[model samples]
Structure formats: structure tokens, C-alpha cells
Target: MSGIKLICGKELDRVFRDRKMIFSVFFLPVIIMVGIMSLVGNLSNNAQKDVEAHTSIVYIQNSPVGFPQFLKAADKDCKIYEMSDWEKATEMIKNGDADLLIKFPENFVDMVSGYKQGDVIPQIKTYYNPSEDYSRAAYDTISTGVLEAYRQSLLSQRVDNMEGLTVFTVNSDNPDMVIQDEEKAGGKILGMMLPYFVTILLFAGAMGIGTDMVAGEKERGTMASLLVSPIKRSSIVLGKVIALMIISGVSSVIYVGALVAFMPQMIGGADLGMNLTLNPKQIAMLAVLLVAIAFLYSAIIVLVSVFARTTKEASSYVMPVYMLILVLGMTTMFTTKTPGEWVYAVPIYNTSLALQGILTQEVTTMQYGITLGMTLVFGAVLIGVIGKAFESEKVMSI
Candidate 1:
């Protein structure tokens, strides 16, 4: 245990001194998160502003009518561009010179009056470019305004005459169904991103530190020198595994911390209205899950590293494992089906799924215990296997 601690300290110092290691574990993730947030925030703000701006629409009619006055009165922000030719109006809209093009039927006034007097309403034909998002929104807004004006005209005519009508009461199981939109958003973002981020950072940290411990040592001829030392083979394996776990664990913490720090800003500026802040209990759960993930990934990476003749070979060997982790982490995004108990026994899958639950504040004690236990058990088995590999004469020769 003392030897393992000493080795862990040495490995931690080495990583701190290495500029490349520092960038990979800390700086890279921070840069990526901040850059992505800034880009998304700018795009969202622009979309909202564009939607708010009530730009000019070209109206084409065969005969003069009062409908134009109704549209103009609907919103003070609206700008109406009246045109006699439908073709010219359409061309303007298509060329981005106009926001919208409206065409009124020849008998539009008669049709509206007839409908108000208990006649069948004719379906109004509206043409819009489905490919344009803003065009669709503008069409909806204009249609809604026109309908409200027509309803108001009808109501004004019937203001002096009224009749009593029967009213029915409704009974509902969900009477006060108020959705806390903020909490829902927080839960959704955490569920979607937490697992993926944890898996990626864990794999990256393990690969970075594991390569140095095994293949790098071999290249430096330090493995041969270490073999001649009076240390037991199991102790050497233990030491390396501990060191790898520390590096992976520290990286996971940094990645998660970056996410937590950005959550308030994300909720405030973005549509996520969640009044969420992580408390000590949630932090503790996340810490435990991170530790378990680090241990499991470290053991697997060390085993893969032991089989490699060089750092390049170790990275190649680790690629498939990393891909598998990515696929499992993304399982939550595409799946609505609940994972079976057997899935909780899988190493990376268990930790990632559990971390997702923790972040969303939906994790149960039983689920957490099962995931943590399985991760530790698998890690122990993997460490035993790696220990045997390290003791082998063939592995030492490589």
C-alpha cells in the first residue's frame, strides 16, 4: 500500500510537469465546452431576434377589399406591401426581397360575410416554401391575426343579443398539471451529456497515462531496469494501476467540474429554465461514480497497454474499447426502453448509466450500489489478469 502511494505521487508529479498531459486532462475540455456554449448562445439569440422582427409582406389581390385594413390593424409592428400582380409578389418573396406573399381570392369579402351568416366557410389556399423556417413562422402569425380579427367582427355584431346555454363541468385526475419547465430542461441536458462526457474523459485519461506507464517505459528501457529491482511483480503491477487510476480520476473530476460551473449560465441564457444547483449529496454521488469509472477504465487500459510493444500499438489496441464506451454512453440518447439488470453488470455501461441517473437526481441507492459493486468487481478481476501478465517472462521481454 505504501509503495502504491509513493508510485501514485510520482506519477501525479510527472503528469503535472508534462505540458501535453496538462492540456489533455484540463485545458482541452474547458476550451471545447466554452467554445460550443458561445456558438450555441449566439445562434439562439439571433433566431429569437429574427422571429421577433415583423418584416414586410407583399399582398396581391384581384379586387380592392377591407381585409388589408384588418391585417394592418392586427399588429402595429406589421408592414404591408400591397401589389396587384401575384407573380411579381411571389418573385419578390422568392428572391428574399419580401418576408411573405399573400394572395386574396376575388370573392374573399363575400365568402367571409357568408360564413359569418351561418354559411359553409370556404377553405383559404395558402402557399409557402416549406424549406424556409422563417416563412412558416410568418405565415402562422399572419393567419392567427386574421382569424382573431374576423372573430372580433362577429362578436361585435352579436353584442346586443345573447342566449343562455348549458355548461358542463370537467373532472380530471390531473387537475393542477403545472409543468416545471426549468427542472425538466435541467434533467434532460444532464441525462443527454453526462454519460457521454464521463466515458470520453475516462477513456482519454486512461489511454494517456497507461501508454506512458507501459509502452513508454519499454521504449525508455526503464522496464528492464525496474525488473532488476527488489520489488515483487504484483507490487509493480499494483503501483502502475494505482497511478493510472489517479490520473484518470483527476481528469474525470475536472471534466465534471467544468460542466457544473457552466450549468447556471446554460440555464439562464438558454431555454433551460431549471433553477438547479448541485448540492453536497449530488456531488458525493458523482464523485463515487467517477472513481468507479476511473478504476474500471484504468484496469482495462493497463491490460491493453501490457500487450503493446509501443505507445502507438497500445493506442491502436485501445481504440476498440473506446469506441465501445462511446456506443454504450450514447445508449441513453437513442433508447427509451429500460435497460435490464444484466446491463448494470457491464463495466463502462454501468458507471455511465449510473452517472446519468445521478446527474438527473433519479438514482436509487440499490442502483448506485449495484453499479459501484459491479465496476469495482470487474476492475479487480482485470487488475488480477494484468498482474499475471506483468509477472510473465514474455511480457517483460516485450
Candidate 2:
């Protein structure tokens, strides 16, 4: 145990003493995260403002007597044009010269006013390019604002009471009607985004430092000297693994912290509702799960680093593993279906799933146990295998 601690301290000292390594691993990520995300948020806000300020060019065919007046009153930015030629209007809309085209049936007002129980109904048709943001916005504004208001006016003219039409309303402007865990709301949002990033970062952090630790040492012939020392092989493996885990864990924490701190500002200052009120148990579970992920990732990276003869070869070998981790992590983002409990036993994917579950406060004890136990068990087996590899005279001497 003392030997392991000594070697671990030495490994940590080597990294900490180097100022370049410290800045690159810890500080650069914060700068990048802030710079990139702030740019994206500003762009998004500017685009939204531009779209809202745009004047929509609208062509109305067979306009009702008060329809144009209603439209102009509702939307000051609507540029109303009366055009009877359908083909010209269609061409104008398709050419991006116009944002919307609306055609009302002849005698639309008369049809509504003189409607009987079994009469023909008048339908209004709208044409717009769905691909164009301005066109789509125009359509939505007209449909919900002008057309809906006009329809309501007609309904009032025909019926004595409009309230009879609504059978029931959900929530009905009552805030108390909605049942939600406000504390867990942010968890859902984080669950969707954080799991994938956490999985990727854990492995990426391990890969970045792990490759140069063991494989680089071998390439530089430091492994030969270390092998000749009085220290046991298991202590070397444990020491290196512990050091790698600590460095990668701290790196992952910094990265994730930057993301959380910068994300809200990057999204135009929108309220993320990330109210975290975690109890002691939840915090403990989260810590355990994160430790498990870091350990598992460190072991895998070290295993690959040990098998390879050079840092470049180790990097090449770790690429496929990184890709696999990426794919597994993304499953949390795209997958909506609830997975079976057995899924919790799977290594890379389960950690992501478990992290999501923990964040959302929906993970069962059984599921958490399965994921944590399997990950640690796998990590331990990998450490044992790496220890044996360290013992191989042919493997390390090369």
C-alpha cells in the first residue's frame, strides 16, 4: 500500500510540476467552453430578433370586407396585398418575394352568416414555403391571430353563447393544476445533455493522459528502470492507475463545471430551471457513480496503453474505444424508450443510463447497484489483467 502511494505521488508530482500540462488540462477548457457557447447564444438571439422584426409580405385573394382590416390591426408588420391572380401569388411565394398567400372562398362572409345546420362549409386555404422561417412565421401568425379572431367574430354572430363549445379546459390558467417537481426539472434537462458529455469526457480525459503515462514511459525506456526497482509490479499498476484516475477525474470535473456554469449564458440567458436540491443520499449516489465511471475509464485506457508498444499505437488503438463510448453516450440523447433492467449490466452504456437516471432522480436501487457493481467489477478485472501484463518480461522490455 505504501509503495502504491509513493508511486502514485511521484506520478502526480511529475504532472503537477509541469506548468504547460496544468494549463492545457485545466484552464484551456474553461476558455473554450465560454468562448464558443457565448458566441452561439449571441447568434441565436440575434437571429430570433431579426426574424421577429421582419415585415411579412402577404397576398390575400377574395378578402372578406373586414378581414384585411383585422389582419392589419393584429399584425403591424404584415404588408397586405390584394391579388386576384392565384398563379402569380403562388409564383411570388415560391420565389421568396412573398411570405404568405391566403385564399378565401367567394361569399365566405355570407356563407358563415347564412349557415344552417346542414349547409356547405367554407374553407380558407393558405400557401407558404415551410422551408422559409419568415413564411412559416407568417402562416402561424395569420392562422392563430387574424383567421382565428375572424372565425370567433363569425361564431358570435351565429351563436348566442360561445362558452357552450368548450366541454372542458386543461389547467385553464390555473398554476396549481400542474403537478411537477421543480427541483427535478433541471435534472430532466441535464439528464438529456449531461450523460452523453460525461461519458465522452471521462474516457477522453483518460485517453489524453493515460496514453503518455504508461506507453510513453515504455517508449522512453523508463519502464525498464521501473521494472528493475525493488517495487512490486502490482504496486506500479495501482500507482499509475490511481494517478491517472485522479488527474482525469479532476479534469472531467473542471470540464463539466465549466459547461454548467456557462450553459445558461450561452442560451441567451434563458431560465434552465436547474434548481438542484439534492439530498445526502442522492449526492452520495452521484459521487459513487462518477468514481465508478472514472475508475472504469482509467482502467480501459491503461489496458490499451499497456498492450501497445508506443503512444501513437496506443492512441490508434484507443480511437475505436472512444468511438464506441461516443455512440453509447449518445443513446441517452436519442433514445426515449425505457430500457430493460438487464441493460444496467452493460458497461459503457449502463454508466450513461445510470447517470441520466441519477440526474432525473428516477433511478431504482437495483438499477444503480447493478451499474455500479458491474463497472467496478470490470475495472478490477482490467487492473488485474494490466498487472499481469506489467509482469511480462517480453511485453515491458520492448
Per-residue CA lDDT of candidate 1, range 1-398, in tens? 77666666777788889898789777787678767776777777778777677464545454236656776677556666666677877776676556666665667666755555566665544555545556666677766566556656755654554233215445557667766556545765777777887788778867867877887788788888877777777778888888888878887778767876776554336665445567788778878878877888888998998888888888899999889888988887665666677777777777877777776677678888899999999999999999888889798678
Q: Please, what are the lDDT tens digits per residue for candidate 2 over residues 23-117?
A: 87778766876788788888888888887899999999888898888888899768999987889889988888999998899988889888888
Q: TM-score each candidate.
A: 0.83, 0.92
lDDT of the candidates, in the order given: 0.73, 0.87
Estimate the overall C-alpha local distance difference test score of candidate 1. 0.73
lDDT, residue 241, model 2: 94
Model 1 alpha-carbon miss at residue 112, Å = 2.6
Error of 1 at 32 (Å): 3.4
The TM-score that candidate 2 achieves is 0.92
